[model samples]
Structure formats: structure tokens, C-alpha cells
Target chain A: MKKIVVSLLLSLSLLGLGNAWAVDSLNISLAPEQANPPSPQMGDWLKFHSVIENSGSQAAHGVVAWISLVQVDPGHEQPVDLEDWSAHKAVTQAILQPGQQVKVEWPMRLIQAGAYRVVISAVDRETGHVMTSPFVDFQVRRKPVVDSGRILPVALGVPMLVLGMMAWRRYRRRTGV
Target chain B: MNPITLIARKEAGELLMSGRGLAWLLALSVIMSVLSLLLVSNTELSLLDNAQVVYMVMGTVTALGALLAVVLGSDAVAGERERGSLMPLLLAPVTPSQIVFGKMGGQVAGWVVMYLLSLPYVWAVGSSGQNLTQAVAYLALFGTPVVLGFGFLGIALSARLRSVRSALLTSLITLMLLASPLLLGPSLRQSAIGKLFDAVNPFSAAVNSFDSVVIDSQPLAMQINRLAISLVWLVLTAVFAIRSVRKMEI
Candidate 1:
């Protein structure tokens, strides 16, 4: 019984040490509430935006950030194309000093109409300390659109030509062309 | 007096006496010089900038050169006939071809002088770029043919036509046609049925040459097609002008 108690105490102490050693180096949060989200029109894609803060005493570097997205019920997580969003995992070079925060905008696309929940994560360079953003929810809808301004320039040009012709003819009659 | 020398000397002397040509020369020099200064300052005297500077010089000089060509060409035979000097020139012992060639030479001489007058200003603009030397080389060598081409059309038109006023207006129209690519390149190239406009247009060819030499770092080889087309037009107009002069009974 004494040996078993000693073994249990050792394992508990190790677990406590492990939890204590983990640093709180970074924090991330959505900066603004997107009240009225714009529909991802044609050629538009999905995007996630947030503010990342290095709350620790030292400046943070080698930051690898991610945006994980999932559908509501019966959820499935999918990887994002940084190129499509023009944001990447390698903001590692940025050194944000203590109390300094950087705004990150991530773009994404929805191929189908649905509800989505997005979560952002920021990992520190050396410590590997992680910070997670609040989950932001959005809805994507499908609709049809028609463009009518295609012929506007040409349509306006004809009337301008007619007015110019009338003025030119009047000038010719006066000047004897 | 021989037809060519007399007409050349007489026309040259008149141009020298007229303050109008000098005024244009002064304007051209000022304009080209200022353009060179602006470009040279931006280019920091790079060789490419130098070429652009030379091109700017060429552009300004050519404009002035074309203007002089048009004025001389429009005035050539028509102005003479309008002022009652055509009869004396026609009545001379020289044949009509000799008279035509002589008048053409005089007009060409005036244009050459006008082009020469812009050289100092051109050099100033091109001082920063590699094209300064190349431009000067081309100006002294290839520029004459261009002058001949533009001058030929104007002079030939004057020889065939009897009204200087009409010739002047037509020369302006021709200059606009020659430069249409500058004004109409995008509209004609972008709109519906743009393909036909690009294919048939000679002005596009000239603008292409300008782009190659001025904007792109290409040599005169790229402009050979434009040069050839211009030469063909020159030859056809010359033939027509000579025929018209030969056909003139008076």
C-alpha cells in the first residue's frame, strides 16, 4: 500500500509539473463582430479575420497561425488554402512585443449554402504555446444575379453622337462648309 | 539654271527669310529641351532613360519635322500656282519631272534643316540614356528616309492639286491619319470588330514601331515592316504626282 501510494504521488507531481511548465505566451480573438456578413458573390471566397496579441513579456516570433472551419451539425473540419485567402501559416517572422497585437485577415470560400463555425489558432515559435480565438459563426446563402450595365457606355455614346452631329450641322450652315 | 538646283535654292532661301520657320524651330527646341530635362531627371541618367530621352527628342522633332513637311508640301506646287509663280516655273526650260523633283528637293531640304535644328535639344534629353548616340546615328542616317516618305506625300499632293488651302487641310488630315494609332489604338483594338481594324491599319504599324523603339528595348529591326509600308505609300504617291505634273498642259 505504501509503495502504491508513493507511485501515485510521483505520477500526480509529474502531471502538475507538466501543466505548470506550459507558458501562456499568446492570445487571439476576433476583433469585430461581423453583424451583416456579405454573401460570397461569384469569384468571392471564405475569409476569417482576427487580432493576435503577444501578451507575454518577450516579443514573439516564428508564429504559425491557422483557421479551422467546420459545418454546424454533423461537423467536418476542412483545411484552408492560404493562397486563396492571401494569408498563410508563416507569419513567423513577425516579432510582436509585449502588449502588441497584429490584425490578421483570412479569406475563405463556401461552395455550398450552409452554416459554419470558424476557429483561429496561433502558436508561438520557441515555446510552442498556443492561443485560440473565439468561435465565429456565419451563414452562406445561394442567390441569382443579372448584369445590365454591360451596354451602358455604348448606349450613352449614341445620343452624344447625335447631339454633336446637330451642332456640327448648324455650324456648317453658319460657316458655309 | 537647272531645274533641281534653282528650285531648291529658291525655296530654301524663302524658308530662311520667313520668320515662321524660325518660330517653329524655337518652339520645337524649347519643347524638346524641357521634355529631356524632365525625363533625364527621373531616369537618373540610366542608359535606358537615355534612349527614352532620345525617343522623346525624336518624337518632338518628328512632330515639328512633320509639321514643316506638311507646310512645305502643301505649299509646294499649289502655293506656287496660287501666287502665279507656277506658270514661270512650268514655262522654264526644265521638264515637269525636273521641276517636280526640284520642288520636292527644296521641301525635303527645309524639313532636314528643321530636324537638324532640334539636335541640340535632343542631345540634352538623351544625355542620360544610351539612345542619345543611337538616336543621333539614326537621325543622321535613317531619319532622312522618314522625312522623304512624309515630304513626298505632301509634295506630291501639292503637285497634283491646285488649291493650297485644300492641300493644307488635307495634309493635316493625313498627319492625323498617320498618327491615328496614338489616339485610336485602344478604342479600335478593344471594341467589337477590333481585329479588322488592327489588321488593315498602317497607323498601328507606326505606333508599334514607336512602342518597340521608345518603350521596349528593341532595335530598328522591329520597325522594318512599318518602314516598308511607308516606302510603298511614298512611291505610289510619287508616281501619281509625277504623272499629274506630266499631264498638266500649262
Candidate 2:
């Protein structure tokens, strides 16, 4: 009787473990498969390619890959939140059979100069399986703001300003205000 | 000379000689140059994409054109009556409807001049990208209706009101309301209300049309809805202005 009870408990524990393993079978990894770019310039486009694989014995359906900015420079913050950053495009795969791999690309435009890393996550909507990629680190340096750009405003502003002043003075003279 | 042409030419000439005209030209010059200069100075490819440059130029031009419309048209009837200049035109053989048409023509002419002034900057920024001609074409095609809509709106307001102060203030407020979408955060701007505003506001429609054409590279079929909505707004405003002018007293 004691032996039978121990055997039954052992069987139930193994089943639970198997279920947990099955749910955590999705793997996500970054692209280039080599040394990533250490420093990318501001206003540059970086294609963050990701690969998703299902290592479980069962098929995964409705898998979603979410890309998010995990961190930035101490002083530099994104103008928008994580949702807006990823809102431009969505990465989703309808189904991934066991041992099947899929590739996805997240095109990002760097608007601010700073250090940043992106976190890619793959989630199975049906089973609530979640897999996260390691932080991808990169630095974006600032480019010099051209001084020549001011010429347009000055050239345009000065003449308009002068003309406005002349008009104001004339109006004052005519109305004696 | 045709009464409409005469009115348009006279109005155009007056704006060119007035302080307001100079101010408009000056504002356009500075804004355009500054935008170009920023693009030129930014060495990064992503800092200022060709599409982005085109978007900026088109948006600024459209917004400014709309502003000029309000500034000029807000005073059309009210200011004229305030200064006792409407009496002469009212007493003239030209019909009130003809005068309204003439004013619309002048507004269109002013917007065209603004467009012409933006050409150099548009060329400089747009040429950097592969689609200068396309950007210019979109600017011209969509820009006309934006000017017409806002111009007519201002004219209608001016015609309905007896005080130039009230007309100008109301016009400015309306313009601010139309442009308020620009101030919204990206998330909020993507909300239901934001989408509705973009579709309903002629100014926003023009900007979105440019974005669709230039940035997204969407074909005209995809953009037909936006252009159509803009045209509807323009036509409605024009009808309202004509009615107001028709019902107004000397």
C-alpha cells in the first residue's frame, strides 16, 4: 500500500513538471549571430532581426514577438513610450511547429543620441508561454547641428521684422496712437 | 476687365504692398530656410529622411497658407465695413456673389504665391530624396483645397460678424482648434478622437495625404478617401461663405 502511494505521487509530480516544460519551450534570439554594432549614429536605421523557435513537442499558435526599448542614456529619453515605439509595426506568426524557426525584423529609426538596448519577447497567446531575448546594447552619438540652417530663419525673419516695424511705425504716425 | 479678375488683382496688389504681405513673405522665407538648414546640417541619414523633409515642408506650407487665408479673409467684409470701404464695392454694379468669388480668387492667389516662395526649399530638401517631383505635385494638388477651405471659412466668419476684432479672433481661434492635433502626444494622436480629427480637419487631411504619398509611399487609391474628405470640407465651406455673402447688407 505504501509503495503504491509513493508511486502515485511520483507520477503526478512528473506530469506537472512536463506541463511546465511544455509551456516554456519558445526560444527568441537576436540576428547577425555575431558581434553586434557597438555604436550606431543618431538618426540611423538599425534592423533588429530576431529568430523564434519552438522547441516543445506540441505546436504553438498565435505567437507574438514584442520589441521594446529597455533602457536609454541617463539624460536622453524617448519622445514616446514603449507602445508608440512598437506601434509602427507588429510581429506575429500564426503557427510554429516543434523544431520550427521563424525570422522577423524590427526596423528602428534612432532619433535621439544615447545608449540603448532593445528587449524582444515571444509570447504564446494560447498557452501563455513567454520567451525573452537578451538586451542588445548600442550607443548613438550626436551629429553637429548645422549653423547654416539659421540663415534661412534670419534672412526670412529680418526682412519680415523690418517690414513689420515699418508698417507699425507708419500706422502709428497715421493714427497718432 | 472681368469684375472677378479686377477684384482678385486689386486684392493681390494691396496685400503685396501692405505690411501684412511683407510679414507673410518674411515668415515663409524664414520657416523654409530654417527647415532646409536643419536638414543640411544633420549628417545622419535617419536624422532627416527625404520623406520627413518633404513632410515638414508640405505641412509647414499648408499650415502657413491656411493662416494667411484666415489673416486676410477674416477682415474681408468686417474690416472693409469697419473702414467704410465695403460701401463702394457694395454700390458697384458687381453682384455680392461676384465679390465673394473675387475674394476667393485672391485667397487662392495668395496661397499660390506662398507655394511659389516655398519652391526653393522644397526643391533643395525634396531633391535630396528620390521623389521631388512627386512631392511638388502632391503639394500643389492637395494644397489648393486646404487654402480654399480655410479661406472660405474666414470669409464666412468675417461676413457674418460686424466687428473685425471678433472676426479675426474667431478665425484665429478656429485655426488653433484645427491645428491642436499637432500638439497631441503620439499615443493620443493615434486614438479614436485623433483619427476622427485628422479625417475631419482639412488641414490635417492635407498633411496626412502628404504623409501617405511621401512617407508611406501609398498609391492614390489609398489616399482617395483623405482627398475626398478634404474636397468635401472645401465645398461645404465655400457654399457657406457664398450664402453669408449673399445675405449680408451693405
Candidate 3:
């Protein structure tokens, strides 16, 4: 019974050590890069800075951080795909040592007008633990970049003009006008 | 005027000034008008970036230009043969190479008209975005070779194939194959085989160049390799068209 108890204790300690080794100890904080960011408008470019720090005793290997934007507008609440907003969505840090902090900047263009929440998420590749920063809230004012009213006239006018010309030409050819 | 220019003028006149030509132009304008209206008025599409809309418009224009080229070129030889007009042209003083060049000139004229017609829509869609001028410039620079290459492909097929229907069918299928990359999902286009096909496809090169220049705001210097691929396609198709016309049995 004494030998069995010792073996069980040893196995439990080994498992605890392994769990501790794989535990994620990363913290991330995200904020606008500018000290006082202006009110964002449609078509405006903005940048956000995310700081990832390792708060554990061991190094965190293969840390990847990405920025995500979610439209929080009442009727249109959904995560925005970063494909059109930003080209560089994610940044990778090969190894983050204990007490080491890595800063990443994401440049995104505001393509739509709405209320949005931006969050930075980081994952430790080895531990598969995901850590997300607190949300940064912002509102984009509407700036009419494309005037549909102006486009409507040209869109509808050009074709009408071409059709008129075609009809006139056909009439002239047929009637010898 | 030289025989080449005379022939080219005649071909272009027949294609551009005829009732059919006017009808095609009217159709193109209507399509552009509808596309622009939908893009600007639709809530979801309007929310897209202006540059993205411009890129889409440019892509559609290029495809339309290529389709017109293929249609015109397919009819260049086979339609004439069907109408019993090929014998006189073949017996003329002009060489087969000259005739091919003349037909290519006519296709270029059609593409020019198409490009001009697309500008207003491009401007209307992208006026509020970045790289508007660059997008227009790249469309002309890259679009010409792509359209011409497809035109030559059509002419080559028409010269070799005895029937206009077969020539048009083959040319359109070839165009579909070249444009297959555009139909692929983003992830699939990044695969090795997809990359290889895109690298060689003049159509993809034109579309990718438009994406890079218009949407991503990439500089022209970065697009040399893609431009080279388009030029290579133009040269290859031109050679093929000439050879086919020369060897065609009247």
C-alpha cells in the first residue's frame, strides 16, 4: 500500500508539472495608436496598437495576434471580415520571453459607417489558449463617398442617349433622311 | 492608304458602323448603366469600399471586351467563308499575315469603343475612392493585351476550323478556361496549381493587376511580371493566328 501511494503521488505531480508547463500566461491590451484619435468617418484610415506581454515564468512560443472588428449597430450586429478593411490582419511573434512585451500595429480603413467594437486576440500556438483584449468602442460618422443620386442620372442617361442615337441612325438609314 | 490599313478600316467600319454594331454598343451601355445603378443603389453593395466597386466594374468591362473580341474574331474568317467572301480576300494582294493584322485591328477598334463606354461607369463607381486614375490607366494598359490575345485566339480557331459555330465555341471555351481562376474561391486560388495557372493566364494577370492597382493601391513597378505574361500571350496568339491563316486551305 505504501509503494502504490508513492507511485500515485509521483504520477499526479508529473501531470501537474505538465499542465503548468502548458498553461498560457499571456495578457494583451489594445488601444488606438493616436493619443487622441479623431472621430472616425467613412473612408478614413485608422490605426490600432496591441501590446502582448508574457506574464508567466516561462517563454511563450509562436504567439499570433490579430485584430477583429464587430459592427455593433442595433440591426447589423456581426463580426466584420477584415479582408477589405486591412491587408495585414495578423502578426506573429516567434517567441515571447517571460516579462517580454511585443507591440503590433494594425492599419484599417473605415469602409462603412456604423458603431463598432475593435478587439485584439492573441493565441499561444503550443497551448492553444486564446486571450482577447478589452473592446475599444468607436463610431464612424457617415460620409457619402459615393453619391448614388449623381450616379443615377449618368447611369440612366448614357444608355438612353445611346439608344436614341441608334434609333435615329436606323430611321435615317431606312427613310434616307 | 496601305493595304493593311485599308483592310483594317473596312473591317472596323463594318463592325462599328453597321446596325449590328450600334445594337451591340447600345447593349453595352445598358448593361453598364444597370450595373452602376445596382452597385450604387443597393444597400449591401453600396457599403462596399469604393475601390472594391471600381475593381469589380473594371473586371466586368475587361471580360466584356474579351467576349466581344472573341465574337468579332470568330466571325472574321469563318463568317466570310460562309458568305463566300473569303475567296476574293484570299486572292487579294495582301498576305495572310496582313489579313490577320487587319482583323486584329478591327477587334482593337471594338475594344477601344468598349473601354470608352466603360469609363463613365468606372468613374461613377470609383469617383469617391482612391487610385481612380491609376485604375483607369491600368485598365487600358493591361486590358488591351488581354482582349487582343483572345481576339487572336478566336481568329486562329476560325482559320483552322471550317465552321463559325465551332470556332466561336472553341474560343469561348478557351476564354472560360483562362478565366476559371476568377471563379475560384480565394483559398483555392492560393494553391500551387492555381498559382501556376494564374501566372500563365493573361486574363487572370489583368484581373490580378487591377486588384493590386485599384484596390490595394500597388504601384505599376510591381506589376511588370503580370504585364509581361499578358504581352507574351498576345505574341503567342498573334503568331498562332498568322500561322493558321497562312496554312488555311482556301
Candidate topping lDDT: 3
Flag regions of model 2 displaced more than 4 Å. A1-24, A27-29, A33-44, A68-90, A93-95, A114-119, A125-129, A132-177, B23-64, B78-97, B115-143, B157-170, B182-199, B204-223, B246-248
- Candidate 3 per-residue lDDT, tens place, B6-86, comes to 878987787666878778778888888887877666544333567778888888888888888999889989989999999
Q: Ranking under DockQ, best-scoring first?
A: 3, 2, 1
Flag the better candidate by DockQ, 1 or 2.
Answer: 2
- Chain A TM-score vs. truth, each candidate: 0.54, 0.67, 0.73
**TM-score: which is higher, 2 or 3?**
3
**Interface RMSD after interface superposition, model 2:** 7.0
CA lDDT, candidate 3, residue A3? 100
- TM-scores of the candidates in the order shown: 0.52, 0.67, 0.81
Model 1, residue B111: what's the lDDT? 72
Q: DockQ of each model against the real complex?
A: 0.02, 0.14, 0.39
Name the top TM-score candidate: 3
B174-236: candidate 2 lDDT, tens digit per residue: 888886654553467787888787778877777777877776666888878788988998899
Each candidate's interface RMSD (Å, one decimal) is 21.8, 7.0, 2.4
Model 2: clashing residue pairs? A43-B46, A149-B37
lDDT per residue as tens, model 3, A38-139? 887777788888889998888988888888899999999999988778988998899999999998888988878899999998888667457889899999
Candidate 1 lDDT for residue A109: 38
